[model samples]
Target: MKVRELREHAKELDFTPQEQVRWLAPRQLARTAVKAVLAAVFAGYSDKREVQEVLDADLLEAPCGQPDAREIWIDYVADVGDGFDATSSVAWTLAEEELLVPRAIEGTDASPAVGDLRLRRGSLLVLGGDEVYPAASATAYEDRMKGPYRAALPKAADPPLMVALPGNHDWYDGLTAFLRMFTQQRPIGGWQTRQTRSYFCVRLPERWWLVGLDSQLGSYFDDPQLRYFEKHLSANLEPGDGVIVCSAEPTWLESVETNADAFNALHWFDRNMIRTRAVPGSKRRVPTHASVRLWLTGDHHHYARYAERLPGDPPGTGVPAPDSRRRQMVTSGMGGAYLAATHRLPAVLPLPPPGSRLREKDPPVAFARMGRTYPDAEESRRLARGIAVPWSGRWLPWRNLGFAKLAAGLHAGLFLLLCFLFALAEGVLRPVDAVRRAGLDDFWGFGAVCLGVAAALFVLGFLGRLLRRILRRLRRRRGAAPPSGPEVATARTALPPSGPAVATLSQALVALAALAITVAIPFPPSWDGWLVLLLCLALAAFLGAFVGSGVFALWVLSAKGGQVAEWQMSGQSIEDHKGFLRLRIAPGGDLTLYPLVLKTICRDWELRDEPSGGKRPVPTGKPAVRLIEDPVVISRGA
Candidate 1:
């Protein structure tokens, strides 16, 4: 298609229902912060699981298929519902009847080679988590997620079943919209939703199972959910059965600073529920031979697998151990969200964590990274550089105009405030004289109000600290380790400052210096003070808009703080290097995973007439689809 034709076609297509989330936008930032705080505060009080239980909404059916129905195909995607380009690309790919294999499947010692594999659409579609971006709302879900997917495949004669796990974003609205959309027995495009709650279990063929857990913003699992799982899982699981567990976040990979609660919950579930077959009131709990064969998640927005290391095998090698019941922990969150960096993933992961309560009694177990990252670490590093100069090519201030304006406004406000402080410092007003000149009959009242505001702020800070202390004490009582998320390691603490702490300190120092330089130079109002003020304001705005992103880039480059990197990259709205998983269960209960990736998304779309005489988007360019790695095979042990 010609450029003009493409532009016209795009305009007429209405291809995108919602634009990608501008994470750095001031309003979006504030809204997200408020939502986060409110969600955390009221998650327990407004527990949706309790409501579901009260309503008897538990639709826990036997895992998806029959015991003998061993062979099946399942598609897994996570962290979806962001930009139209990326989300649509994934939806389009999943909607296709079949995909042509690009390369031969070279055999490995662990997995046999099945060359010339033709990838077909799965009967079951599993959305790992974060199905929508920014926050969860009915409109947001319809626009960002359902719209693109519906356009991709409006209908199917034998539609695939769809299920989803709720991520942090999905829980922003307490799963109100999520449950309504997914559990209403409605259809999203050609995919059908049958899950009655946020969490679900699918029984695949040959005693294999797929369990999607709703961690509820990485907080504690409710009693109802635990009971539901026990009723279905513990009662039915047999010896030597293989299970696949899916969660919204890759808690195994997250550091204590990022998701300690999630990590603890996952390990606890794995141990008590899966391993020991223990429940709240089990009389005699015996360690079950049934094992969790694979652990899957999607909050990280990338493809990374931490495969259990064989007894004597070297790390990063593709060799599989004989009779190995070792599990593979994979993160395939690249459904449609902004890409996360894989360069920072550690080579080795010690399960249950080194010093956690879970590890205190168990033997050490480790997982070595299996293959290179989907985009590769080097490619991720290169992509990360884009954050440094996010506005290099574009019209005017580019798509970051909102962020720029926010920065500029904040800078101007700060400059004005600093000027007032400077004036006060220079004795521009004696307190008594100022009060008299202002001619306020309610001066004392105004003072009281100001003092009250200050006191309120002080109380809030104190309460926050007190809450943390109480939580820590509660954890100790429960024989759990203290969470490290809000705790800062300093010289005063017994533990030394870690890499993230160092990076945070450096970032803070840089920010302070920038603030000092912006205000210090324009000090002491003189005859030419207005010019100085204008220059300072202009500089401050420029810094907020342009240089603020540079600081973010610095954090990304350092690759130390996961949260910091996430904040910076969320603004990138990346369109390429998107992917999903195509999993197949063979007749013999062997599971094969194909990590399919599209390096470049199809952008030039044409409005084409379909078989039914309706119009839909047909990409002028075919998506560049390729395999992230050779198919990963986990065999059903004897």
Candidate 2:
């Protein structure tokens, strides 16, 4: 396509259902957004004096003075670190606003990101996991995620309540980071601070009652979430009332047997057939009504829809076995992640086809119990809600070509590999055209052997690294000997107590390696040059695998503080924020602090005191911030 055509196409992908932006004056709104973002990005809101000063300083006063939206986005992009919810709130705002429109045009020659559009109009913006793609850190959130969402927000909005569900990605640094921002849902019991980031019902200006659930809360004893399910399932059984259930992982992708174990039931075979309303002393409080329609989910890296009849509530005998009915399950993880392929319809079953024909279910009960009718709207942790299924259910289906889908990251995967290999030839294996060079042939042989050895070492190194890491963590939990390494006592100076120093080192290594490979390739292609180029590329990859493994190690060690579990009024509505077993620990003897400050900047922990400067006892009130379950492992170095 022509360049203009390409730009036009790019604009098309950023498209959202256009509606008049309310609140802000049109032109003034754009200017305000740009300036506010720029101020928020580089400087923060802590110093209201400066924030307001910056906010008020008219960019138009100076020549080319007003900050452009793209510049604002770029500036906001710089401040993320291991700050959790604060960064999340910002990213959420950016994503919902569809603010990234200008950058989509400026940056590239490809289709815009789909999630770039704001939360659907009149639809409650439900976060179905890893609302923030990486750890809820400032660095990860702002740098890795903020840019893209900002680049996409011109067509979106924060849209009031974004019912967020936690995914492993949200908890990549641990559940606390995920919890810090989303106070409406608390981590369920036994699941640790791994709370049910789920909620029930939202009243948007639109008539629809938007009900949300945190699929991850399914891991507790006495599943209050389940009871809430029965309660709400019974109370809110309105006709055509839609439940836009958000989960990092989708229900249909779940395994029946595994789900049965999580919910402590026989099996949950129906796709999206969540067992909601249960009755007094019943077998299980499975919802019988089918009118609760529409399910939306994420985790997979594509936008897909399944318009078909789902299996009925497994435990409920009241409903006639659904012979066939209309239902749909969708995957909208396409917002941006590792993009994957749209699976072709005639997909062959990886598992054996069921041997026996399926049995039909009985009809649903006519009436649900009273409390059972309403979902527990409280942000309670007793609900055993979770997005727990094996890794296969959560991620197996999607491909991992970052934003490449918008820019050939998907289809171009192999071709990029070929280009990389070709670069190797240009650097290390050239002069084959002058085929008769005998000595060069012998040199080529030596290089190949070395390359092979490097490749093998790379694989072995990664494996050993992974095994050792696993063992080290296992030991930590067992309270055994520490991992074999000189503790970087000075890590505090180099690595903040919030995120990974080791992972940073690894990334630096890979970036340095890619740069080295590029440098190694002596442009016009000579035999020795090609040989060196090839060797460098191989070495880069070999080394990169190890560096990446180091990142994974830090990832495994990550933990953060949780969101407030319970809230109460301080008489005339000046509510005071309270407890959440909030703790921070540094594994390298220095500490990484992923602070759980409520609804603010995703930042490093600033000092905040525990309720009584005392040790943790069973908190009388729900903890607004909980302890980090894992630390973002870092390597302190000289």
Q: Model 1: how far is 117 from its true place, Å?
A: 2.4
Cα-based RMSD of candidate 2: 24.1
Q: For residues 1-638, what per-residue lDDT tens digits would candidate 1 score against the true structure?
A: 43235334444444435556777667888999999899999999998887776544443333244444647888999999987767888899999888886664222234434555688898889999999989999978876899779879889877888999899998899889999889888999788888788888777777787889987887777888887788777667788888899988878766333332337787778776777676447577887677888889998878898878766675543534433356788999999988877776666666665556666666656776766577678877766666666554421125456866765575566545544543454355432222123223333343344446545765666677679878879879889555332121111132222434444444333333343564334243342545565666677667655665455445555544445556545656676779999998887778888988888887666677656654566667668677788778887652
The TM-score of candidate 2 is 0.34
Q: What is the lDDT of candidate 2?
A: 0.30
- CA lDDT of each prediction against the hidden true structure: 0.70, 0.30
lDDT of 1 at 385: 63
Q: Model 2 segments beyond 4 Å from truth?
A: 1-120, 142-159, 184-211, 215-222, 238-242, 251-276, 281-287, 309-325, 343-638
Query: Lowest summed lDDT over 10 consecutive residues: which window, candidate 2?
Result: 563-572
Clashes of each: 3, 101
